[model samples]
Target: MKLKTYDISLVGMFAALMAIGANITSVAPFLQVAGVPLSMQPFFCILAGLLIGSRLGALSMIVYALIGIAGAPVFAGFSGGPGVIIGSTGGFILSYIVAAYVAGRIVERSQNPGLPSFYTASFAGIVLIYVIGTTYMYAALNFWMEVEMTYLGAWGIMSWFIVKDAAFTVLGAVIAPRIYKSVHRGARLGRRSAA
Candidate 1:
């Protein structure tokens, strides 16, 4: 479907949310696993997917990445620039797009994806995020950076975020549908008023 002004705004809003989520303190430990920092940005990424659906959700993530790469201090720990995108944690950053798209696609395809479906979809998306991120991390470390990290070693790093992300998935499953319903309800009201 074509994007309306509201959809565009939501996309931009989620993009901004990604930035804010990345930089927010008290979210997660600054602890590094295999040189990657544990960050809660995935929560917002999955939230965007649930709230906005697939196309816009992925677009939102792309916007977030591009803005950060363009020198906005919008990444985790207030870090940004192409350097961050090419850094060790960049795989996870890029994986947000795929995670959002997959999660949103599942929900959008459903007649009414309630909490259980959202949880399942989001959990799948999270798994995809880890898979893609870890693979990329392995390649980047071994080939690009000459760091010599094995594939299994890369996945080992993801252990730090799995439990936390599982919790966030549950939280997103609960909160996203409520927000989605409210937004759609408002949209319906607005349409009726305009008509």
Candidate 2:
């Protein structure tokens, strides 16, 4: 029997959705400081981008957000509906699209010279996600809630979110390359057997 090769786009989409779901499940309690409560959930977004590449990563995030908005309980804490998107966390949610796109593109472009290159690319993607996600959160809270936040306060919030994401990114960076190599090897083996 001839083995079928999966479409790259489909693989990307499935991976993206799975990453998003992983992110939704990984959320913990919100970090509150000076009455500004922020959920730490950007790691999943970064992971999606790093694994899936820019376009599919962004598309996956958008799809997940849209699904939540359409009343699916696919978001953190099983929360769903349009209210979540329009809440204080909305900007962060929206930022995932930007973060994922930027990260994914960086990862895709850095896919050479083996595992070190992949890890470097993943790190770049992580940085991109944090920058975009934190900036969006700061702006959203400042504008919508009229919070008087100092630079330190903003940094504090950024730090809170960034640490978690960075940890996850590091973990992904370590494991993903091995998984990719294994899959490629398996595919090649299957093809040889078929021949």
Candidate 3:
């Protein structure tokens, strides 16, 4: 399907939002759990899918990842590059695409998505984010990093992340319908103005 300019712009906007979410911890170092800074990525990822649908949301995530891999300071702690992708948090970075797609796909199944749909889709996306991210972190720490954390231990480590993301997921769902309406209406107005 051909994407209108509005769609393309939303994709770029979400990509920029992802960057901002990743580094939000930099200015607030006290917002850490178990020595790991809390990241707002899951929130933005869900918003991207809920507001823009699957394809554009995933595209935005991909663009964000590429920018980081290309040495942009868009990742957590203002860090970036290929090394970040191979790091313990890399799985979480990669999981954003799938999470957004899954959330969007589920919500898109309904003709007119509502609060219930948003709740379901947001929760589903958070599950994928934690599963993929925790598993990869476990593998990276045990194998290359030589930290030797058991699978269960990895889950335990992610417990804090889970709590934080769960809250964010609910917030996203609650606010999404309003944002979706505003954004789509604005796009229509923009088109009419252009015409």
Candidate 4:
């Protein structure tokens, strides 16, 4: 009734891919609130980290981005291709990779995947994503729009993004462990029955 080592690896890979798919499907268009457009993709980023661990979680996001860049219609609004990466949403899209990595690393290091710790990791990851995304956005605006963005503009951009991301983080923190445990238990049961 013992599962083979390779079986475990395969299961893990499957789980990672499932999470990636979930993330890709979860993507939404930028939310325009009070004249600021905010990217809300960081929710999936943190969820990927908490569920898949740092390396695999980050890899999932990177793979998703590459697939979209390679012309898969898997991105937000069913959009895809390299142009999207160079588009306005590019910075936020790129930040997902780092956010997942940071969250995964924090949870793994703390060795406490409990809800509170997971929430903290998710929040921290969101912060990291915002830092990178806002900075990139500012630079891109300057380069493309030919205007120096004010600090208030940057803060405004980050505000809606953070709000959406925080909502997702809270949902992920509450739901991910329950989902993981259920799936893992089911898989184990299946293995035992097979054995």
Candidate 1: tens digits of C-alpha lDDT, residues 45-147: 9988887788889999999999999998898778889998777889889999999999989988889778877887788788888888888888889888999
Candidate 2: which stretches are off by over 4 Å? 1-41, 111-113, 182-195
- Best-to-worst order by lDDT is 3, 1, 4, 2
Enumerate clash totals for all models, in the order shown: 0, 1, 0, 0
lDDT winner: 3
**Global lDDT of model 3:** 0.90
Give the range where candidate 1 is weakest over 10 consecutive residues by summed lDDT: 26-35
Question: Can you list the residue pairs that collide in candidate 3?
Answer: none
User: Per-residue lDDT for 82-109 in model 2, tens only?
Assistant: 8876665566667778877876676567
- Which runs in model 1 stand beyond 4 Å of their true positions? 26-38, 189-195
**Relative to the unseen true structure, what is the C-alpha lDDT of residue 155 in candidate 1, on a scale of 0 to 100?**
78
lDDT of 3 by residue, 1-195 (tens): 566788789999999999988877777778787777778899999899988888888889999999999999999878999999899999999999999999988888978999999999999999999999999999999999899889999999788879989989999999998888888797787677767
lDDT of 4: 0.69
User: What is the alpha-carbon lDDT of model 2 when measured against the actual structure?
Assistant: 0.62
Better of 3 and 4 by TM-score: 3
> Each candidate: RMSD to true structure?
3.1, 5.8, 2.0, 5.4
- Relative to the true structure, candidate 1 reaches a TM of 0.87
Q: How close is candidate 4 to the true structure, as a TM-score?
A: 0.72
